[model samples]
Target: MYQVRVLVLCGAHPLYTNWTAPRSTFTSLLPRAKDRHWSLLLHQGLPLNNMAIFAKAPTTCVSFLLPGPVIIQTDEASSEVLYPNYQNCWSLREKTRGRKKAAILQPGISKDLEKVKAGVGINSSDEVDFFVLLDNVAAEQVHSLLSCPALKRFAQMIEQRAVDTALYMLQEEDREGIQMAVGPFLHLLEGNLLKAADPTTPSGKTRKLYLYATHDVTLMPILMALGIFDHKWPPFAADLTMELYQHQESKEWFVQLYYHGEEQVPRGCPDKLCPLDKFLNTMSLYAVSPEKYHMLCSQAQTMELGE
Candidate 1:
């Protein structure tokens, strides 16, 4: 029996930087599981950034790559946990570092903002699926603030103009970077696997596969675009996690996402997002079957977000 192991590292922005470095705790943790053939999945840009950091390391480290095939995918979700009420001077001051210029807005931009506000609404689910929703109070506060006409208008404008521009640039950069780093590894594995299997004779036997993803919060939008996550709602802290197991009794893989840590609302909060670490540890041990694994790979292939 092939014992499949899936490990996920979850946290906010900076933690990703740590994982990509040679001397970081993430590297140290790798050896502990080295005995088993491993695969990696980064939820957002974490894996991409980590790879860049690894390349810069002075000492050559072979441990970063697994003996088997490694697959990397990028997830694009927003990292903004606390949506402040830009309409309120005090709130705006706090969030903008008391800079009047930062808080002030132009008229044309404000008009476009109203259109954006009209386009989106808050999520009203009682039991939220991810960790970021844990802070009910904070979530509510943000909701209330965002509901304001002025702030909503401004947010919409920013989303269309500034936010979209930056996200597009980052997404392209990350996608290209991950492909360059792992492309060769993927080709090698695919070639070897194809040769091992007899093409002339159709065999019913299925192979066990391991997979991983690395990505960033912006991954949420990409996921939604690719039809992986249907809910139009943005991802939250606890929402970021890794899903692992088998598909169709033949294939195995992992899906991951990243969210801001502060977005995790505790259970008592009105929104009720779970804790990050607890959620991940729970899912890591979940069971998997070959049929289910095959199904997962099929869906993943259809998603077409990963190269």
Candidate 2:
């Protein structure tokens, strides 16, 4: 059998049924795994849940939501510490073009979006208005709307486009976009891959699985950084898994990425199973070293906030 290490990036709050339901099903399948770690790393806004599967599992204190380390100016001089600044490339995107309707969307799509907004009692003409309205829509109301096949299809399309707008704003060409969006997390993921490939490391020898629980905002940027985002709203419990394998004979290492359950061929890879060196090189484009990450974040100026 191929020796493998698994890493799962979960992007959803467990409080929602949508997140909990699929999580339950996924956990049930691995009831007997011997070497696994489930880290409930979360943003400050999310309430921590220590019960359930995490009751006995250790958790990471690091919040992977930000780029890590903040530089502050004191009365005496300047200092750098671990903290969050809301002025990241991802957050600054709100001040850019994400909130406005893109010129490229077809007129028919615009009409459909307007109809979706109206159905949900949204009076605003903003392109992203429906997302705000839909968040508060009662589950029963959504169920009733989805009961009709046409309405269900329309709902899917609108939701996907709304999420796509958010993704589009994080394009690599944007100022420090990929760096501010996923620098720390990308660095950590690269470290994991490195450790998994080495047999003498503690994590490589003992840990077989690693899980990170986060939100859609964090997940989308990661997907975009990896060049695998499908431009769809990540439904409840959406996850990305990275599997690293070592051949038994030649002992060569390879990587495979999966979104939800479907295998993905990440950009810069020639095949579904990518050699470790090639995968690392592709990811290096988005990865930032600790010193550089802190410097870039310290230089950021806050932009206007919005959806």
Candidate 3:
């Protein structure tokens, strides 16, 4: 049986890069800011993306993506744990997804099936439905705003601005975040591809698929790290796929990359198809070896100012 490892990553968070709430833009999304009591929500982790600014102090909210690797036996019928659930849909709008998208679903905090996890303010049926619709709105915004140029720049700027660690905790978080996910994925990639190419290896004859089911939070950093992300947001179900092929003529292997169905030329890949040897060599720099991802997590968190 082939043991395949898959990575699942994403988290809900709010990021502020030198914001000034009550700025002119706040009137655009939050018209009632002047009259409504927003500090409560703000304190409760409501993400106000470029939402004009709020406080003089920097904000620290938990919006993260980690590469959680789970090994599944490819030959087994019981390997259904990695799939998505068909039930339990939540449509809340309290939490914002990211810059390009507005607030969306933060479903009932249920850990197991059979019962609904009690939420803070979900008292009535109307509130429950409102939360569901909030999720829908967040999804709609994602569908409409993901590919904008501003998003690409926004993504790029986050990385660029992150260099100055005085503003935010981005430098370590961004790098460590990627090291957690991409690094592992790369490990799986290189190891599996090598196995597939080696005739002496026991599992060399088997074909494998390395799947990653992630939230946009983690995808943004990874895309940026790959140097292919144009700073725009990626929609749901979007995938960054890579395939390996063997050449019968030279007995060599090669790699092809794709992002959201479009062929992508990664930093090392000059063409649509890159020789597997070259691809590995080019990609070797990114895979964080010698250091475990959890090590990064164990360190203390930092807070920096925004540019």
- Candidate topping TM-score: 2
- Sort by TM-score, best first: 2, 3, 1
Provide the TM-score for each candidate, comma-separated: 0.23, 0.61, 0.44
lDDT of 2 by residue, 34-63 (tens): 311232222222222111131122222322
Q: What TM-score does structure 1 among the candidates reach?
A: 0.23
**What's the candidate order when arranged by decreasing lDDT?**
2, 3, 1
For all candidates in order, the CA lDDT equals: 0.31, 0.55, 0.42
- After superposition on all CA atoms, what RMSD does each candidate show versus the true structure? 18.6, 11.1, 20.4
Residues 216-258 of candidate 1 have per-residue lDDT tens digits of 3334433322223333334222233322232446443222333
Please list all clashing residue pairs in model 2, or write none if there are none: none
Report the C-alpha displacement of residue 91, candidate 1, in angstroms. Answer: 34
In candidate 3, how many Å is residue 102 off?
19
User: In angstroms, how far off is 173's CA in candidate 2?
Assistant: 4.0
